[model samples]
Target: MISSPPKLREGLEVIRGMDDIPLIFDPVSGHYHRITRSAEALLGYLDGTRTRDDLVAYFSENARVDQARADAFSRQLDTFLAGLERSGLLEGSEQTEQGTGASPSAGGKRFRTSMLMPRVVLTRSLPTVLEPVARVLRALPARLIVVLATLGAVTGYAFGFHTLFTGTPGLRDLAGPAFLIATGVMLLIVLAHESAHALVAQYLKVPIRGLGVALLFYFMPVAYVDRTDAYRLRGRGGRVLLAMAGVLSDGWFCGVVGLVALNSSGLVQHTAAFLLGMQMFLLIVNLNPLMPSDGYTAVEAAAGLTNMRGRAFTLLRHTIRRQPLPEHLARFGTGARRWHVTYALASVAYGCFLAYAMFHTIPLSVDLALSVVGR
Candidate 1:
């Protein structure tokens, strides 16, 4: 029962999102909270000049509600304001008794980190360095770039694959120096892919926290840029573009290399063809929706959902066990329930298909490698 009018802390930014949804960003915590439209309206009145009773009276007058209904509304408003206070969005308010402070979500953790995917941050100043490039990209015709890149990728891959299976050099011919050259090119492609994500995020005014390298699953090395702040973006379009930027850059690289492979001969042709194949393989992995890849992120952004994979898998587990739905899930609307179940089943099926493909492809790949290395 705070008698004083609760004021929002200084430096909090409220951005309007899709469908007029409001998102409040707290720079200190580097987290953003999605709030309802009504909540946003209520926030406007909390300028340290109005108390809880004043809000209730305002609501009563506006809605033409009786005293009984107004009392109920007052209680609801209290709860909402209390939540905001706990989230550290209110000025001069302490967190809960536990002293752990409020978090961005119910999970109570801002970041998902694991030892299996350890990252070494390369630099925190990428935004400043990449600002000029981002501005240039923003100034260009985005639709034209997308169209050209898409068309080039399709044409180059068609010709490249034709050359690959028809009359290109054998694995023996592509060994040693050609192989090393292709590997170097593949590494550069990976760097460009990550840089594209960062650049798009910067263009959208999302904070680039860091650029880094990480060992995914404790083995596979990957370049990653921390664009988690993209979640704070107001529009779904910006978020989806940020997610797909890496894939687009990969397509552009493949397009260039694939065309080169189609026209060239000797070592250059072999190396470019090899690099194209490697890029295609990486694209497949990146675009697998069953995993937490770029494709999954894009889907989540498009649907304006969060933690879809986690929710889907949880629902799948409960269904398999014939157990009751968890409290949070039980609250889902009809459409959401169906979506979660469908995604879960689809993920399961896709995973099986991948396992089957790998089972058959691994032996062939090993044989190809052995032949190439002169074993």
Candidate 2:
């Protein structure tokens, strides 16, 4: 073993919980770690005076790690140290003895949709900075808010379903300046969607870290609020509510717009109709449980796992490679595996659905393009 002391990066904030597992935040990377008790204790051994062997001996004894598990424990520790080095969280960067081959099902080789779409933060602590608004919203009755949101969502869906079933022969009407107005409204709805997430999280006393717009595949602008810190909620219910808030906001927005579409005339009616189309698209796509959007995050929160999607992908990877189930999968039990497998199936189905949607959805937007090209 390499004999060098590992020092944690300075100014790191660690939030210790009732479960003894602490959540460590690295401001530099904007990453949070929910580390086990042993892992939390291991950080203390990073003093410059301690050696690798000493650190291993200390954790191994405290962990009561048996002979069969000692090797695995050492490999994990070595890997964690390596990760810390990579993140610039360690003062000294030294290679460990073992390769620390992480389990694929345990987020070793997990993939992310964010890899396709990168984000840039415009503001941090946006909710805190807008504390006066949060305070006003907090005083409002939760039951009333939930009731209105639920009613709006139901009305939005009912109106939308009727439109879809009745056929949109009015697509030709959408090929006009009204489309431009609708596009602008749709953009505002995106911001409102993110705002809803922030408001709900703030009301729940879950700190909102930041809000920003990201380039989706370098073109489509996607707005997001950083309510990720809410994952540490002791109960999944709060996290689920937070996750669903954006979608709920879309429902209310579309419901209001749909009513205008029904009651208005001429240019106003056409613009409202155009927005209604976009809103339905948002509802269908965002509410999809398979996408990496709010619905998927809600599923993750409900399951109480931060790496739910990654773990699901890992299961698929192991199955394709014909490898034995990873050690972590063993804890899920048979019933859990059934749901995991179902999720895997849903994920695959979504991939196919997206392929079809893109094929059709692209041409649907061609009118907007032709308008630009003609000019």
Candidate 3:
């Protein structure tokens, strides 16, 4: 969310007789100006259907500005609108036509305008097949996680887990193609996860809002489904499936890659190993249930929490109140209470790790591999 725009600098000339063009009047200091043509196009979008938050997002994506900049612009726009109202120039209807009375027409509805983007929540609603998937997830015996972990270990070993030492030559050779493939494959896996969520939501007759790259964390973009409307849904189980869909998709990918790793050879072996390792990383990291990742959403849904952050805070607040009171609360408290702390710390660590990987590890590793392969 962004604050309202600072009042425009004093004495800025108000462009009069530009009612056809979207214009703003700042009565606080008696200044007015025509909104840019692009801004006019944006104001034309005030259909009373799209939320201000959505408009802010449209600006952010279409304008290619960072969220903060977009938000600031939104606030500025709001100030402009407020100014128009103060000048007795606004008709309450966002649309301005020649000679339309500044007073709202009987049919005109006042718009609640502001430049605020709703927090992008990471929850999605489920479809008909979600129940089956949930059943699979619930019945995923401990043996499955162990088996998956062991498979991951095997693939990790194959993909140069031992390259921490005597440098696997083939592993080094796998870097470029591996980088390209791994990145592409990981993207595909994410797409599949999003598709599962969306298709299931569609199956259940939920309107899919839209899909786009979400900044899941700083420097990490993941596809997100806007399933907040699902909160208004009926059954708890369906909601749970929506939340768990992505992680289940990750597990499914891990299973498939694990099977391939057990059967392939040469470059296929390398590819399989890379994919298996990648899936394992996603499964483990994403399933941590700490941050706003897929697993966290699952945990939130399962715990009957309104939101992950809210759940964490409630648990923490209760824990603080119950100090020296009960064993159960303390024991279960970490899972709930410590969640926000864990998420914050983990995010910081993950960010640092990413920075290191990009600046130090990736360059050194890729350069060495390219050098070796070139040799």
- TM-score per candidate, in order? 0.73, 0.74, 0.47
Cα lDDT of model 3 by residue, 265-353, tens digit = 55565666666656656666666654556677666666655444533444455555765522323445445546565655565576567
- Which runs of model 1 end up more than 4 angstroms from their true locations? 1-7, 46-58, 71-75, 91-119, 167-181, 214-221, 231-236, 263-270, 304-330, 341-375
Please give the CA lDDT of all the candidate structures.
Answer: 0.73, 0.68, 0.51
User: Which scores better on lDDT, 1 or 2?
Assistant: 1
- Model 2: lDDT of residue 66: 91
The alpha-carbon RMSD values of the candidates against the true structure, listed in the order shown, are 5.5, 6.3, 18.8
- lDDT digits (tens) for residues 1-375 of candidate 2: 344777787776777522333776655445565666767767877866776767778767988989768778778778777666665567755322111111111111222235234666666656766678878877888778778887887887677546533533376755466788889989888988888888887887766766776654454557777665674466677777888888887877776776676667777877787777788788876777776678887877776666666567667677678888765665677777777777877877776766676678776577665764564
Question: What residue runs in model 2 are displaced by over 4 Å at the alpha carbon?
Answer: 16-21, 56-88, 94-113, 123-125, 141-144, 159-169, 173-175, 217-221, 312-356, 359-363, 368-375
Prediction 2 global C-alpha lDDT: 0.68
Candidate 2 residue 366 C-alpha distance from true site, Å: 3.4
lDDT of 1 by residue, 99-176 (tens): 111222222233344423566676677788889988887788987766775676567556656667664676656655
Q: Ranking under lDDT, best-scoring first?
A: 1, 2, 3
Comparing 1 and 3 by TM-score, which wins?
Answer: 1
List candidate 3 stretches off by more than 4 Å: 1-175, 310-360, 368-375
